[model samples]
Target chain A: AQRVTQPEKLLSVFKGAPVELKCNYSYSGSPELFWYVQYSRQRLQLLLRHISRESIKGFTADLNKGETSFHLKKPFAQEEDSAMYYCALMHDYKLSFGAGTTVTVRA
Target chain B: GAGVSQSPSNKVTEKGKDVELRCDPISGHTALYWYRQSLGQGLEFLIYFQGNSAPDKSGLPSDRFSAERTGGSVSTLTIQRTQQEDSAVYLCASSYNTGQPQHFGDGTRLSIL
Candidate 1:
């Protein structure tokens, strides 16, 4: 069975402060990892994928195979960054999602 | 192109009643999936239809839940004799194929009263 775990249910940081949303997964095969964000009243959209190794909105996540982790990071947080972030694991046709971290960027 | 679209943005029904939620996939998407987002919970896989192949229904919570994809374009998830426990936002997503990024609809918020 494939599982994604986001240990934090909520993370708060002051504006301009660094933030990290930790995610870990357990999958036997080479894994595909993604971080998805849902802003208030908006559709869930892909933020970044580990395979792409690209940054979106100043956020990037590096998959660490040794640790079995893919943690999203940003040097600075913006007030608009307050949203629900979900970490997902792709398996076959299904993607198992974490419980999600509600990030609050306080000004 | 437009993303996945789900019908009846919000539905409130009494317990024991049956409810049907609809999904319209992207124009060229060959894979459609149904997921449930319960209050304060993560997305739960419900079912997936890929191309013309049989759907994977292993994620279904119980026999009370059933879904069908017609003509490889639209789908409807039916919950028989619904209970308050069935309350959740029913999300529909579609992808070009398996392992591809999925586009989701705003979802149908079903409140079983």
Candidate 2:
């Protein structure tokens, strides 16, 4: 079985400050990690995947095999970046998601 | 449709009543999935349908939960004798194929009275 854990339930930051949403996972086989975001009144959407190794909306996540972590980071937070973020692990086409973290960016 | 579509954005029903939720996957997508999101359980996979093959129902919480996809496009999830614990946001998602990134719907909020 695979599991994803997000230690933080909520994170608050001032505009222009750096932010990080931590995520950890436990899986026996190779793991595929992804970050998904849900904006207010909007559907959940894929933010980025570990395989892609690309940044989206100034956010990036690095998959660390030794630590079994895939933490999402943004260099500078923006008001528009406030949203609920979920970390997920895929195994056999089924995704196991973390409890999620709500991010608030204050002006 | 352009993206995954789910019907009945919100539903409130008696505990013993049966309820059905619908999901319309993106056109040409071969993989569809159903998940339940609750305050305590986060997101739990319920079932998955790939093309016309037998669905993977291993994630279903109980026998009272069942789902079916017809013509490999639209899927319906039926809960029999719904219980208060069944109240949650049921979400539907689709991908072009297994291991592909999924696109999700707004989800249907089921409230059991």
Candidate 3:
């Protein structure tokens, strides 16, 4: 069994400030981690994955196996970056998701 | 032909009625998935289809919930005797492989009154 936890339900930050969304997982095997984002009235899309190792739209995440953490980070937050973010773990045949965090960037 | 598409974008069904949600995955994709999103809840995995095989159905809440994927491209989820508690946004996703990044649809909002 695998589980994902995103402790904060809502996070608010000022525009141009740095932002980080915390995510932790519990898995024994080699697991795949991902960060998914959903904008207002839009479908959920893949923001970035740990395996990709690429900065997507200025956002990047590093997988920490020892701590079992995969936190999304952005150097400079923009007003348009405000949205719902979910962290997931692909375990076997199922993908378990975290409760999610609602990010609000105040301009 | 494009991204994953779900039919009946918004459905309002009465309690005790049956509802079916459809999903058309991207062309040539062999894997499909069904998920549910409720208020304040991120996304819950309901089922996954990998070339017509779903090894995980444990996420399904009850026997009233069922899903099937045929021809390895399209899928449908059926809920029998729907209850108000079942009202939520049903989402479908697909990928070329099990480990591939998934593409999602806008989802179908089901309201059981």
Candidate 4:
């Protein structure tokens, strides 16, 4: 079965500092990874996908087959960057999500 | 365009009572999904509906949980004899088709007292 693991439950970073949310998955087949974000009082939205290889809101994630990881990263975290982030693995037409990481960008 | 919409943004029901959560997928979206968001469990896939195909109930936790999508647009998840453990945010999402990015709803926070 495919599974996603987000090691960090919570992360606190100063404004303008770098923030990295670690995500690792286990899947026998080729994996499709995605990062979803949910802001306070907002619906969960797609942040980025590995297949696109394009950064969204200054966040980018690279899928590493060797490491089985697809960690999301942002060079300079901003106040609005605080949100709950989830790493998901898509397989068999469904998604398996991680426990998620709550990031807080403190000013 | 409007995103996926879920009704009863918040629901409070007593244990042993039945509750139904509604999900209205984005117009023109043929793939709809149901998920449960617990305190620390992230999002757990509950079911999937694609067009007129049979729904996938493999992710459902128990017999008390069931879902149905009518006319391939609106979906309703029914939980019979709800338990406290069922108290969580029920989320619904929809996509254009397979392998497409899913647009999520605001979610309905179900609280069982």
TM-score of 2: 0.99
RMSD list, candidates in order: 1.1, 0.6, 1.3, 1.0
Question: Which residue runs of candidate 3 sit more than 4 Å off their true CA positions?
Answer: none
In terms of lDDT, the poorest run of 10 residues in model 2 chain A is A1-10
lDDT for each residue of candidate 3 in A1-107, tens digit (9 for 90 to 100): 68999999999999999999999999989979999999999999999988879999999999999999999999999999999999999887567899999999999
lDDT at residue A2 of model 1 (Cα atoms): 93
True lDDT of residue B88, candidate 3: 96
Leading candidate by lDDT? 2
Per-candidate DockQ vs. reference: 0.82, 0.94, 0.75, 0.88
User: TM-scores, in order shown?
Assistant: 0.97, 0.99, 0.96, 0.97
- lDDT per residue for candidate 1 within A4-97, as digits (tens), equals 9999999999999999999999999999999999999998888998898999999999999999999999999999999999999998868899
lDDT for A80 in candidate 2 is: 100
lDDT at position A72, candidate 3 = 94
Give the better candidate number (1 or 3) by lDDT.
Answer: 1
Error in Å for residue A103 of model 4: 0.8
lDDT of 4 by residue, A23-101 (tens): 9999999999999999999999999999999989999999999999999999999999999999999997798999989
Strongest candidate by TM-score: 2
Q: Report the C-alpha displacement of residue B102, candidate 4, in angstroms.
A: 1.1
State residue A42's C-alpha deviation in candidate 1, in Å: 0.9
True lDDT of residue A89, candidate 1: 91
Candidate 2 residue-wise lDDT, A1-107, digit = tens: 78899999999999999999999999999999999999999999999999999999999999999999999999999999999999999999999999999999999
- Cα error, residue A9 of model 3, in Å, equals 0.9
Q: Write the per-residue lDDT of candidate 4 for residues B1-113, one digit (tens) a residue.
A: 58898989999999999999999999999999999999867699999999999999999999999999999999999999999999999999999997798889999999999
